[model samples]
Target chain A: MYQDWIWGLVGGGLIGIAAALYLLVNGRILGASGILGGLVDGTERAHSKERLAFLAGLVLVPVSVVPFYSSVDTHLTPNLAVVIFAGLLVGVGTRLANGCTSGHGVCGISRLAPRGMVATVFYLLGGGASLLLFKHVLGVI
Target chain B: MRALFAFIAGGTFGTGLVVSGMTDTTKVQGWLDIFGDWDPTLAFVLGGAVVPMFFAWRYTDGRLPRLGGKFPAPPEPKLDHNLVLGSLIFGLGWGLAGLCPGPAIASLSYGGFGGGVFLIAMIAGMLAAPPARRWLDAVAGSS
Candidate 1:
C-alpha cells in the first residue's frame, strides 16, 4: 500500500518546484487564489490572458491525469448549503487577506515574510477552532 | 513564452495537489481534526513543499528573474485588524469545507456538480470582495 505521507511529500515537492519555476520565470508568486481572484475582481486585466492560460493549464493537466489515476478523491462536503457558505467565506476572506494556502502558506512562509507567517498562524488557529466547534461542539460538519 | 511557462507552472502545481492528496477533503479535515483521528499527511506535504521553495527564495536574493521582469514587491510586514480578521474567517471556511482555492480548482475535472457549485459561489464571493472591502474601509474610517 502507498503510504499517505510519502505521497504527500512527493506531491508537495512538485508543488514547490512549480512555485519556484513560476517565480524564476514569471516574476510572480504562484498563488492559486490570488491568480483566480484577480481575474474574478478584474484587478488583473493587464495579465488576464496569462492568468487564464495558467488556469487552463491547471485544470487541464489534472483532468488528463484522471484517466490513469481514476481514484483521485476530492472529498468535498455533500451539503449544498454548507458548501456554498464555505465557498463564499473562502473567496471573500482570501481576497480580503490578500493570500491563501498557496500564496501565504507555501510561498509566503518560505520567504520568511512576517505577513505570511502571521497570516498562516491565524488561519491555522481559526481552522482548528472551527473544527473543534463543528465536529465536537455542534456535531455538524 | 510567458503564457507557456505560466501553463507549465500551473500544470505542475495541479499535479502536486493531486499527488499529495491535497485534493481530498477527508485528509484535509483529518489534519484539522486534532481531537479526532488526526492525520499528519498534510503537514508532510507542507514540509516537503517548503524545502524546494526555501532554495528558490534564496536563489532570487539580489538577482533578477530569468525572464527579465521585476520581481513582485514584498508585501508590507505590518499586522492589522483586517489581516487577522480575514485570515480567521478564511480558516473557519477552510475547516468547514476542507477545501481551499488550489484544491478546489484542480479537483474540478472530476469534482462533479458539487464542485461546480462551490466554484461558482467562490467566484461570486471573490467578485464581491472589493465592494465589501470598500464598505469595511468606510466603516473603519467613520469609527
Candidate 2:
C-alpha cells in the first residue's frame, strides 16, 4: 500500500516532467481533449498522420503498462449512458475553455496565466464540491 | 513539431496514469466512494503531481528553447461570466462521469464497454461547441 502511493507520486512526477519537456521541446500544450479535438475539427493545425500518431501514443502507453503494473484491476466500469454523458460534457467543457485539466491545470498554471489560476481554482473546488454533492448531498454513493 | 511533441506528451502522460494505477476504473470508483471505504489514493496522486510540478515550474520559468521556436503558451481567457459558467458545466459533467478526456481515452487502450461510448459522446460534445457558440452569439446579438 505504501509502495503504491510512492509509485503513484513518482509516476505523477514523471508526468509533470514530461509535460514540461513537451512544452520546451515540442512547443505544444499537453491537453488531451485539445489534441483529440484538433484531429476531427479540420483545424489544419495537425495532419492525419499527426493525429493518428498522437492518438496512438495515448493508447500504446497504457498498453505497455500491463507487464510491470499488473496489480491494477479495471473491473468497476460505469454504465454506458453515464460514460457517454460524462464524456460529452467534459468534451464540451474542454472546448468552451479551450483546454482540459492538463492544459489549464498543469501547463497554463505553470506559466502563471491568470486564467489558468482561476480555472484551476474552480476546477479543484468544483471537483470537491461535486464529490460532496454526489456522495453527500444526493446520497448517490 | 507540435505533432511529434503531442505524441511524446501523450505517451508520457499515459505512462504516468498507468504507473499510478489511475487508468483503472475500479480504483477511481473506489476513491470516489468516500463513505463505503475512504480510499486516499487520489490524494497521493495529486501529491505526486504537485511535487514535480513545483520543480518544473521553477526551472522552466524564464527559459527558452533553441529548436522549438517559442513556447506555445496558452493565451489567458478573459475572466467573466463565461469562465464561471463553463467551469460549472464542466464540474457537473466530471461529477456525473468519472471519465474525463485523458482517462477516457487512456482506458480505451485496455478495452472496455464504457470507453467506446465515452469517446463517441466526447466527439459529439466537441462537435456541438461550434453551433452552440453561434447560437449563444445570436442570442446575445438579439438581446
Candidate 3:
C-alpha cells in the first residue's frame, strides 16, 4: 500500500488519461495553469465558465475524495515567508512562461514539443540548483 | 458540452494528484533533492503520464475533437527568454515549496493554513505578472 512509485505510476496514468480526454473531447490542451491563469489574468473571459468548471472539479473532487480514503497531509513549509515567496514565484513564473508542470511537464513533453522539453530541462536544473543552495548549503529546506 | 468534459478531466487529474502523492510537498521536495536522500517517485509519475499522452498525440493527427473545436496546434518551436527565465523562476519556487500549480491547488482541500497563504500569494503574483510581461516584451522589442 505504501509502495510510492507504483502508486505514482498509477496516478500518473490517470492524469494522462485526463489530459487525453480533454484533448480528444474538448479540442484543447489540458493545462492546469493555462486553464486557471487565463481567469486570473482575465485573458480567458471568453471561456470563464468552462475554466471555472474545470477548476471546480480540480478543487472539489480532491476535497470530496480525500476524505473517503484518508486525510491528506501536505507537509508544506511551516515558515510563512518561505510559503509566500514560493507561491509568488510559481504564479509569476508559470504565467509568464504560459505553462507549468501540467502544461509543460506533462502535456508538452508527451507530444515531444521542443518548447516543453526545453522548459522541463531548465526547470529541473533550476530546482536542483535551488536545493543545493537552500537545502544543502543553508539547510533551509 | 465542453464544460462537462473539462470538469471530468479536472476531476481525474485531481484524483491522480492525490493518489500519486504529488500533493505531498515532501515527496516533491525529495524528488528535487538530488544530493540528499533523494526520492525517485516523481520520475515514475512523469513517465507514466507521458506514455499514454504519447499515443494520444498520435491519435489526434487528423481527427477532430468529438465536441466541437479543433485540437490545440503543436506548440511553437521557438525558444524564448520568457520561457526559460520564467521556468527557472518557477523551478526555484518548486524547489523551495515542493508544490506546483496542480498539486498546490489540489492540496488546498487539506493543506490547512500554509496552503491558504500560498494560494493567496500565488494569485497575487498572477495578478502582477501581466503588466510585467508586457513591459518585458516592450523592452525586448526595443533592444
Candidate 4:
C-alpha cells in the first residue's frame, strides 16, 4: 500500500516536472487538450513532423503499456448525449481558460501566477463540488 | 528539444493514465461518487500524484529547461469574467462527462468506442470555440 502510494507520487511528480520542462525548454505549454487539439488540426511548419510525432507518442505510449496494466472494466456508461455534451462543454472551457487543469493546476501554479493559483483552487473546489452534486444531488451513481 | 521532450513526457503521462485505470470513465464516475459511498481510490491516486509534485517543484529551481524554447505565456494576468465562466463550464462538463482531455487521450490508447467519441467531441468543441468567441464578441459589441 505504502509503495503504491509512493509510486503514484513519483509518477505524478515525473509528469509535472516533465510538463514544466516541456514548456520551459520546448516552448510548448503541456496542456493535454491543447496538444491533442493541435494534432487533429494538423500543422505544416518546419517542426510539424515533430509535433505530429509528439502527439503520436501520447497515443502510442498507452498502447504500449496495456500489456502490464491489464484493462479494468468499468460497468457504467453515461448516455451518448450526456458524454458528447460534456466533451463539448469541456472543450469550450479549455479554450476560454487558455489551458486545462494541467496547464493551470500543475504548470501554471508552479510558476506562481496568481491566476494559476486561483484557478487550481477553483479546479479542485469545482471538482469536489461537482462530485457532490453528481452523486448526492443528481444521484448519478 | 522542449517539443521533443514535451511529446515524450505527455505520452508517458498518457500511458500512466491508461495503466492506472483512469481512462475508464466508469472509474472516473466512480471516483466522483463521494456520497454514494466514496471509493477512496481516487484520493489515493491524487495523493500519489501530489507527493512527487512537491519534490519536483522543490528541486527545479526555475532553471531554463535544457530545451531552449519555452511555451508562450498568456498575454494578460487579470482574472476577468472569462476565467470564472470558463472554470464553471469546465467543472460542469467534467462532472457530467466523467472524462477530460488527459483521460480521453489515455483512453485513446485502448482504441475503445467511448474514447473515439470523446476524442472527436473534444476536438469539435475546441475547434468551435474561436467562432463562438467571435459571435459572443460581436453580440456584446452590438449591445
Judging by DockQ against the true structure, name the best candidate. 3
- B31-85 per-residue lDDT for model 3 (tens digits): 8888888888888899989888999999998889899778888877989988998
TM-score of each: 0.95, 0.82, 0.95, 0.79
- The predictions' CA RMSDs to the true structure, in order, are 1.6, 3.3, 1.7, 3.7
Across B8-57, the per-residue lDDT of candidate 1 in tens digits comes to 99999999999888888878888877777778787888888888988999
Instruction: List model 4 lDDT by residue over B44-79, tens digit each.
Output: 555444444445444445554455643364447888
The true-versus-predicted C-alpha distance at residue A38 of model 4, in Å, is 4.3
RMSD of 3: 1.7
Q: Which clashing pairs does model 4 show?
A: A9-B48, A26-B2, A27-B69, A27-B70, A27-B71
lDDT of 2 by residue, A7-79 (tens): 7687667667667766666555667777788876766464456556667777777677546645554453456
Q: Candidate 2, residue B58: CA error in Å?
A: 5.1
Point to the candidate with the largest lDDT.
3
lDDT of 2 by residue, B1-143 (tens): 65666676677787887777666655655555554455677667656665565566566558765344665554846775445555555655665565567767776755466667778888898888667667766776888
What residue runs in model 2 are displaced by over 4 Å at the alpha carbon?
A: A1-4, A47-51, A66-71, A76-78, A135-141, B1-5, B29-40, B50-66, B136-143
Q: Native contacts recovered, in order, as a fraction for each?
A: 0.80, 0.55, 0.85, 0.49
Which candidate order results from sorting by lDDT in descending order? 3, 1, 2, 4
Which residue pairs collide in model 3, if any?
A: none
Candidate 1 lDDT tens digits, A12-54? 9999999999998888899988999998787888778778888
User: What DockQ results do all the predictions give, each relative to the true complex?
Assistant: 0.77, 0.53, 0.79, 0.47
